[model samples]
Target: MCRWLVYAGSAIRPEELLYKVDHSLIDQSMHSKLGATTLNGDGFGMGWYDGPRPPGLFRGIGPAWGDRNLRELSEHLESPLFFAHIRASTGSPVQESNCHPFRYRDWLWMHNGEIHGFHQIKRELVLAIEPELFPHLEGSTDSELMFYLALSYGLRDDPIAGVARMVGHVERVAAAHDIRDPMQMTIATSDGEHVWVFRYSTQHQSRSLFYSRRIEALRELYPDNANFRRLSEQTRIIVSEPLGDLPGAWHEVPESACGLVDPGRDFLQDFHPEPV
Candidate 1:
């Protein structure tokens, strides 16, 4: 599994989330305490949405903590919504193209889990992607392939439903190949407007995924904390783990669920897979 974070709300420097927190995304890349692995140095990538523009992406093929370019960019780039991920490869090669926050047009996606026995079902899954979208496939990692599968199933119109279909498709294909416990995922996907995250797996025990408590709530819980003062009411950070140990600053997203951090109120709802 990998580690990832999604920031939606005010336009702020990426470094605040990527480097300034207690267990910042960059810090997690090197010393993760709750991930499947402690070191997620295979690669890293970030994609952010700015006003009225297509998202911008920066990916590198090494430890995120040591990437000078990643650090430099994080310090200067600010956006209202962004995704940052540090990867730990399951079986894929460590190439830049295989980095998370994979892009297609205005959308950005990243995931922290894998499709069990991907090699066995890769051909069928790849062939299922829409013809127009399949040509855009650029890497061999199941993570990227999964993103395209969701898109193929209408992710641009509805995130949760599209993903449900994608997961359903994967499980059906895996079952046909007799692969048990066929998938595990904690995913984030966006089209520069709405950010949707899902935590699900065939085994019902997905992974560590959490969203921040409302800033208003955090302000009351930690009255003197300056970090809470700067955020807008809509500001929400969806991370793989808590960045700090603040008592009520973070809430674990329930297993087999989906979260949407929107421009208005956010939502946490049950997610169930459906046939594609």
Candidate 2:
């Protein structure tokens, strides 16, 4: 239902992907090729790690394509690891607080897709969040609630398992309410260093997710491409959709999969939801 991207590796201006690319995130906000909706103009957000400070965040309740501040900030803000999301509300109100790339302490998170019948199941899921975390729930979107649910299940300690538990917990509640196939998500979260991504849903048809091929390999394919010149061999991007159609440059993540992208190495593995 939305478009987003995460970058890890060498520090670079976000505009390179948000505005400069052929089908950039900004472009996708209005002309999404893979998302369920064509217009992701409800709101937008950006989160990035800069130095030792907590990650910087900027969110706005406006079309990303026309946001003057988003455009201006993207041009100057450079980060080794960053996340950008443009939203198309499933049912949540269009508000700044509902925009993605949600932050908690040093962590940042964003999501695409929704929990079917979220309104019917919201109260139950919200009640399950850790009492302390419940106060930090700043938005009404299912995505933010999912973030806290994962944290309640232990995201700060074990991100993958925490999210798995969160998903499992949600499905359990949904089943009680007679809402079948309640989960659909492609999520990305980071803690100023490593980034973790997941693609999964109860119905087995998750949304699009792709990662950039190794910069070393990309260089071999496009020696004259200046974009690859500065990126480190480990530089990786996990996106809702491809930034361009460069052959061998993008690889679709398998269904029900989870992966990690760090400064060292990146890998993907099968993912499944288990009982909490």
Candidate 3:
């Protein structure tokens, strides 16, 4: 599994989220306390939306902590929405194409888990993708394939439902191959505006996921903190784990839940697989 985070709120340098926090994403890449792997040094990537243009991506086939390019870019680039992921390869090659935060036009996606026995169902899953979209598939990781699958099922129309449909298809095919517990994922997808995050697994014990508490409340608690003061009240972050140690700073996303972070609201609802 990998570790990732999505930030949707006021435009700010990516470093504010990637490096400023106590247990920042960079820190997690080195010594993750809750991730499946303590060292996610296989690779790293970031995707951010600037204006009306398609989201920009910066992926590297090296540890995030030591990448000077990643450090420089994070300090300079600013966007209202962004995704950062540090990978720990399960079986895929450690190359730029296999990195997280895969993009399609205006959308960006990252995942922190895998589809069990993907090789057993790869052919069927790949064939299910819309032909036009299939040509755009550029990576071999199950994470990227999952992103394209969501797009094929209408992610552009309804992200939550589209992802649910994708999951359903993978599980359906896995079951046909006599595989049990076919899926495990903590996924984040954004269309340059709203961000949708999902946590689910066939075994019902998904990976860790948490979202920050409302910024206003954090401000009230730490009035003197410059970090909280700089952030807008609408800021919401969905991360693989808590970025800081502040009490009430993070809330665990429920098992089998879909979390939506829109303009000024964040909410959760039950998530169930649905056939496309």
lDDT of 3: 0.92
Per-residue lDDT tens digits for candidate 3, residues 34-145, read: 9899999999999999999999999999999999999999999889899999999999999999998999999999999999999989999999999999999998999999
Misplaced by over 4 Å in model 3 are none
Residue 130 displacement in candidate 3 (angstroms) = 0.3
Write candidate 1's Cα lDDT for 1-276 as tens digits. Answer: 799999998889999988998889988988899999999999999999887888999999889999999889988888989999999999999998999889999999999999999999999999999999988999989999999999999899888999999999999999999999988999999988888999999999898999998889989998898878988989999999889677778889999999888867689999999986
- TM-score: model 3 vs. ground truth: 0.98
> Which 10 successive residues of model 3 have the least lDDT summed?
258-267
What lDDT tens digits, residue by residue, belong to model 2 across residues 203-234?
99999999999999999999999989988888
User: What lDDT does model 1 reach?
Assistant: 0.92
- On lDDT, the stronger of 1 and 2 is 2
Name the lDDT value of residue 134 in candidate 2: 88
Looking at model 2, report the run of 10 residues with the lowest lDDT sum: 260-269
